[model samples]
Target chain A: MTDPSSASLSSAETDDGAEAWVDPERVSLKNVLLPLLTFSVLLLIWEAAVWQARIPAWLLPAPTVIGEAFADWWRELLTHSLVTLYETLAGFALSIALGVPLAVAVVYSPVLQKTIYPILLALQSVPKVAIAPLLALWIGFGAMPKIIVVFLVCFFPIVVSTATGLTAVPPALMDLIRSLSASPYQTFVKARFPTAMPHIFVGLKIAITFAVIGAVIGEFVGSESGLGYLILVSSSQSRTPLAFAALVVLTLMSIVLYYAVEYIERLMVPWATKT
Target chain B: MLASSSLEVVTTAGSIDRPKAGARAVTKIQIFDLYKTYATRTGRTTALQKVDLDIRENEFIALVGPSGCGKSTLLKLITALIKPSRGKILLGGTLLDKPSREVGIVFQQPVLMPWRGVLDNVLLPAEILGLDMTEAKARARELLELVGLGGFEDRYPGELSGGMQQRAAICRGLVHNPSVLLMDEPFAALDAMTREDLGFELLRIWERHRKTVVFVTHNISEAILLSDRVVAMSPRPGRIEKVIDIVLPRPRTLDMQFSPEFKAHSDEIRALIRRT
Candidate 1:
């Protein structure tokens, strides 16, 4: 009785297993090698064009000049990078602290959802860059304004993603928990929160990238130190290579932070990755 | 010249005999005058009407019917997942108005938390009920082992096959050791072969644990195989049509399915459902 079905299922599973075995190796090889190769080729072309065209350093710095500038001011660049990173991390952390609870409240209470969701949407629609100068006037040219701008920029995605995650729990799973006579709090912790982790991480990833941009915007408007401030100072001084170096550092920081979030996501919800 | 003779005919041919072992069985769940009506945007629709049933302790009963017969609704009502609209459900002689820890349930889908491993999924009920963690963990392990998933404790639900996942779900339902276990077509999603395998697996588990089970299914042979009595219901204002006692001996094997007695019972139930 078991033979026919078991045989069919086993054959199907073996086929899947064989396909899965080959996929990861090919994907990893392509993911790492292709990006590196593309970046190297692009950099070589940029360097060759600068040499061939004999472009002035002030107009467009070559890759070699940018590298030289990065090496010369490595200490300064590191300090400014640290400042920006701090702002991004702090703002991201604060958003998670405040936004998740707000989302939970919105999800659980219809009255709150009705009253608060529209206001949040309206606030989010207003461009945060337009308010940075006003924030600088209020908080002065310090890290606080940058932090506030980062917080403002990143808060909406967290709230939206968390709320979506909480609401997206399967009805059957909810029924299972409810059937257990679980309290509302128990239901949220055990069923809703865990189920929402993947969605929440998605929001976090998007918000992290935006946070770096927000911090930079804050610095551009008014700040004495930071990668954005460095870029502003270098450009005003006509040190184009230094500005390029600062931009590279900022891009690298953003990439590193995004990947860190993704790494934590994989750790927190390994089951999500498999499917 | 005798006047025209009058005669009365009596036959016990189709009369349902309550399983002999049930003579001393205590009533565990008393469902009285149950009525359910759903108010949709269109209007009120009656889901179930004036249903009455008494379930004996440790008796495995199957509610068999066509789709839309409110069989799943009945399971929901028992678990207090939904209100009956008009009747009383008494568990152990006490009126049940809300979900109680004294009952456990399994749905058509396994519904195992994808985030949880097999053992953790089984311990979910215990954790919710605030039971002893050490004891519950030990029981979870044992239950997993009982379902032939002993070494799979660390595997996530996604890692398991559909049948294995459902088995884990069943283990979760029984983890708390509730007096009654309710299943809503738990094996309906499986292929025929897996369905049969799970049916026998369920029987094995029931034999060992002996909890009062009210299983809902549309499969006639499945009902006959696993249940002590099969309650047939009609659709559109779902109501009980008839109850048939399965007098087959204990520890039933798959080979017994081909016997003449089994065929007779299957034919009888099929005919009854066909008429509905």
Candidate 2:
């Protein structure tokens, strides 16, 4: 309701006509240093608490111990991370490949929407964890099973978001396009699709996080590789630091992928996402 | 039944007023016995009850009415956005039975695609119409200049003021060069000064293009200032209550709006609307 775009656009424009908000000199060092300093203090407290309390290293290992475990198993951790990354990437790609077109079809055709949308919603509601074992059984516990499980997890959000984006065009906008004698496809490509980009990105970002978790679940069910497998192997052998190291890598992977999608969304929909 | 009979008589009477050009009547648009009804929760409510009108080519005709008087509905019917319950709308010599590119519509809102630059926004119609990209781009640049948006071509709709955005919408509407330009309160959202400026600007554009414009507005003065003829309508079962002809000379400006002639016509329309 507020004309936020106008306010922001004008404020961000500098006297010399450059966008000054992105200037490093304007960004306070405190903004970066404060967060880092706080995190370091928390880590020190964690190490001191463990030592003073005489806690077993297996229960909650110190940062130095975790670093040692990380260095010792660096090769295995990196290898497993790659496998998980590939599975997640493959599943994410396949889901997008299948979901976007299917969403377009569903949104464009009432018949397909009426028939398939409810079933898709039902699939999403079903805990995909329950189906991991069945997938492992059918796909023979290789990358295929993990990939399929990840695909199932990621597919719904893309479909739902894409469909919503397609349908969310303002009625006035549609009328404006229609008055030009625009064909259905042209209306979609020109007006509806661009307008829906922000909403579609919402679904994509949500799916990316779930995609990582799904890949981990696939590894948990039956896998010779992946962070999930490493965590399982380390915990079974009381190698908590090793498991903690695998977890740190997995969290980093998820955050990095999620932010990557966010960055693209920002670049593409700069106008719509001013809020 | 009585309304339907009267509607038939009105349609015939309206056609008789049509000036024939060398035995070939060159009416830009013809609405014969137009009626539109909406099925509401309670019952069927008649929005427009058997309306008939004949618009001459290159004439600026204003359809002014009260709220619920079906001015917007009539505009939609003319643009082929909605079908009439019983009637025929003819554009040029061809009956506009379906939505076609023959008419360009400017809605109350700018409705520009926010994601697109001002240049791209103006080219929206061409994109949807699938015209030659190079030609459309050329025409879009021309239109941007025509609308006084030459320097701000790369700016997005979000970057423009409300007045500028509406101006861009006008460019988009006229880009396709349709014979009939349908405007539904396009300047109603603008401030007073901007709206007046745009009204004169539109008049200037109309003089240059000489296209038939069916302008819909609720403001009596706007209708009187811009229209060659002002058709006033009643509320509810929308019916044409009066039609006042402005025999004022061409190239009328903002000052003309305060002239005795303009005020007289404006008062005439105001009285007619109030009576409705």
Candidate 3:
């Protein structure tokens, strides 16, 4: 507990104010190149394995065949990707429109916290996949149903993370503000909300990833235009490469959406996220 | 509480910039027969009992005791963050029933928001207090410079060492120009050298700002070093055992801690605490 040598070492190691770790935001070429290199290597390996095995495209398409499907079906692929993107964005917007206010209401009112929070937990536990079919039956096969699924998937995490962030203020800071005789509004604006920003971003990132899966789930249950629908129709027709291409689009969509959230977090909560 | 021999040091020891000691100062705070009880799982438990003290304007007092001795509770009570079961506090001749604007607080932790830069962290109190931002920014910058965190204003708390963050916290506590600065073991989390350095830095800040400083600490020597009087408290229905008037020279330093009179006061406090 009282090691003088180690204490001196720790004192010596302190940078005063400089961070010791590698900056997360630092954009080194090696960082970009390493991931790109690995992905290319993996794709090349896949191409070699499929060619050596003489595997049918219907069984498992090689990367090149999938690329060909992309080239051939570019127009249809763009149309489906746009449909999916619209649903994802619409649902995500709806989630933010509702989820953030719901979080604030729940955090402020104990009655709402006790009542609404439990209901949310109960509803959330019933899988979104299970609920998608019911939603489709009730709402019919439209973008509305797909967007609703995305909304359901995205809303809970936003509410939870926002509520947690709103309440997660350090007790000491609470005391400091209290001692200042700060009004409740001042307390929230100055202390509570900023504290919650980082946590809200945490929930937002989680919900963004979930939003894509939700849209896909909705399409799988019953839809005609989204990437999920393309995958279903293509697979049924034994056009495995087309299905694989749809998957590649969905993967890219998820990555782009996640990075969008990450970028916004950097802008909005720079102090929390910046190295 | 002071030995007669050190009366000379007590009066003339302050920096020439600060006012001379030994003149009777106006009473800044009056605690009257205070008692606090908590509703425990087993039943009601008394946290503090029969506490009574007078804090003079611009006087630096330290509350020193072991853990669970209710020193922290007393600070909260003084801030009016919590209420006493019986009796009351008068802050600047006003009844202290709610969180008072007359006092600022420095908690054990720096508690700086990681989302805010050091300047903005110090500016929080001013913003919450609804002071003029233009003036507050000026005062905040001045405080940061005074605390030797001059140029690191834009850095986040994560970038600073524990000592630096605590220094920024001290600036935050003073930015609103509150008459009373209630510190609850503010440097306890810091290393020994940093803690000592901060204690002296605090004295420097206090000498200029002239707040009625109520500093709480478990460290006996720290209490004796920085304070004009050290309030020794005891546990199990915590109450003050003695108020040892340090009577040490103004603008206290770490070197004073090893002096014979400082050791005498330290040993006196240790013996009082051990008696419980």
Candidate achieving the largest TM-score? 1
Q: What value does the lDDT take at residue A66 in candidate 2?
A: 94
- Which candidate ranks first by lDDT, i.e. highest? 3
* Strongest candidate by DockQ: 1
True contacts kept of each: 0.60, 0.64, 0.66
Higher DockQ: candidate 2 or 3?
3
Model 3 reaches an interface RMSD of: 5.8
- What order do you get sorting by lDDT, best first? 3, 1, 2
- Model 1's TM-score against the true structure: 0.91
Question: Candidate 3 on B134-225: residue-level lDDT in tens?
Answer: 99999999998888888889988877778888999999988988899999999999889888878888988987888999999999988888
Which of 1 and 2 is the better model by DockQ?
A: 1
Question: Native contacts recovered by candidate 2, as a share?
Answer: 0.64
TM-scores for every candidate against the unseen true structure = 0.91, 0.89, 0.90
Error of 3 at A223 (Å): 2.2
- Candidate 3 is graded, for docking, as acceptable
Which portions of model 3 show Cα errors greater than 4 Å? A1-42, B1-22
Superior by TM-score: candidate 2 or candidate 3: 3
Q: List the lowest-lDDT window of 10 residues for candidate 2 chain A.
A: A1-10
TM-score of A-chain in each prediction?
0.93, 0.88, 0.89
TM-score of chain B in each prediction: 0.90, 0.90, 0.92
